[model samples]
Target: MPAVPGRLRAVCLAAAVAAVLTGCSSSDDGSGTGSGTGSGEPSVAETPRMTLTAGTELPLDAYERSEDDVYALAKAQNVLTEQCMKRYGLAYDAPDPSPPAHIRPNARIFGLVDAGEAARYGYGSVARTGPAPTKPKSAVLGETAKSVLFGPKTKKSGKALAEMPMSQTAAEKKKSGLVVNGSPVPVGGCLRESYLKLYAPTSSSVDIMYVFNLKGEAESRALSDSRVKKATKAWSACMKKAGYVTAAPASAARDLGFSGEAATGPGAVTAAKADVACKAEVNYAGIRFAVQSAYEKRSADRNAETLGLLREQAQDRLRLASQLTS
Candidate 1:
């Protein structure tokens, strides 16, 4: 899916989880949570703690951004627009980029402690690494083009145009009530018609809002969960020992002066590696992942009906995307 520029990244949802970290205890080995069932270090390890694996499809994660569908839909819209423009003896062109192979799940709490990530980007992975994604190219349609692609405006010249009411029937919907750019604009514009064909097939608004606010509810809980606080404190102390003082790995990565390409370079390799090492040493990933998962599970149970509908629409969109791409 095309990403809006300057979109805020995902944050920790650890605090949202309602489960208590009962079995956890601080281990002398520096891997424990420091408080739980007796002993210096926690007797039980991360294994006993609930953790999400790839085998699971958590509710929030199941709803994905169907990039392939979005790109294909965009192309379809462009083609439709081109045909519409040709009616006026004008040419239209749009460039659609291929979708990404896969988007990584949020790691706001995990902090890239994954062994593979540690071996690669190191501390650089602590923050979002690499440049922002490129948006697919599409012309900024002018009034005439907009009229051709969407619907005509009520006037030949204006800053805003009033939209005419739409009818349920296709033929009726095509009836024009307003003149835009000297052309009659229909109730339900052609552009919107094309969009409907590829997405929102059920005309369900839940499908729209589901993807729009995927993790809003659950993540908020996790961010404030006690488990998250404990994990962050431990991770912060570990980072301080490495000579970096930050509340979380995200904070370290967002320093601007020491992040991304700056810290990812060969010159800063050691620090990058150390960041990952500290993350593992303090078990930040384990703690946060478990806590967040608890919250997500709770949310899934509570919003089953709404989420189920959203999931169906999401799957429908995925199928449409596959058909278009194929």
Candidate 2:
């Protein structure tokens, strides 16, 4: 039976995001050396011995060529293996034909091979014997709500929502305020139509992207309701009871016939925006809530980050919807 090393097992279970970010290859076999023995008949009293070197390059077929060739390959492979083990703090072992079940193929290992070759030939970070593996593209998503909301859906196409021109003048026309609580918040001009375009980055995995879009729509609707005045008032009372300050309604001049309140906390760099948008035709109303909070985490770090970023983006969508409905 092939021995399954513990270190290799750990790499297979690491988070995909961490794997991508750390630039570590999961497919690397912890055992770096190969061995072979001479086939010719030997004296009964003689013991066969082999020589090895660490940090050298060897071809994959070197073992099949000759005793000298096998020795050279074994030495080189052992050297490369030793260097990697030292770098990662893993145990060294001879190569095994059957590796662990979880071990996957990685192109990055080829790079290490090339580096070993280089080290052998006086070339820094170049391999002297076999071909090195290829480096995969880092999965980074684009900066559109739509892109992030839909991952692989957008990854293959490389399409994102159109960017709209930022306009302070347009915001002013609607009686919107700038620098809410000194946070320098930009009032989006096309808040209503823009909701249709916001996408999450593409590099994000599928599950995370779906949650972002789903939550974004939910929060957007909640903020745009005309009945949000009562909800905001209730929420404000709750906040005050919880030791937060109460927010005030918008002034008549700045009010676009929409009912809502804007409040700032004592130490808040920005104020929260809450409003109600009425849709009599559909008999539906929306209550918008907009606020920023420090990113929070849950049990899993990556999941927590995804949720935190999604929540922030959802709040932005709500803010935009408030402007449109107002």
lDDT of each: 0.51, 0.26
Candidate 2 similarity to native, TM-score: 0.15
In model 2, where do residues sit more than 4 Å from their true spots?
1-207, 235-244, 248-326
Q: Tell me the deviation in Å of residue 49 in model 2.
A: 82
Local accuracy of candidate 1 as per-residue lDDT tens digits, 1-326 = 11101111122222212232334333422424232222222212232232223233334565545555555656666565455566555566755555544444453334455555555655564443334557767687676666656664555664224443322234244555555546564444555544555554343435455643546655665566655676677767776787876776666666425665665665355565666666566555665555455455445555678877766766665566566446
| CA shift of 239, model 1, Å | 1.0
Cα lDDT of candidate 2 equals: 0.26
lDDT of 2 at 84: 33
TM-scores of the models, in the given order?
A: 0.64, 0.15
Model 2 per-residue lDDT tens digits across residues 1-326: 00010111111111121111112233321222111011111001111110112322211111112333223333443444333333323334433222122212221221111222322321122232433334434334233322222211224655322232233233233322322223322223122212222222122312324443433443343344222334345544443443445442223113222222221221221111111111111111111111000000111122446455545654553344344334
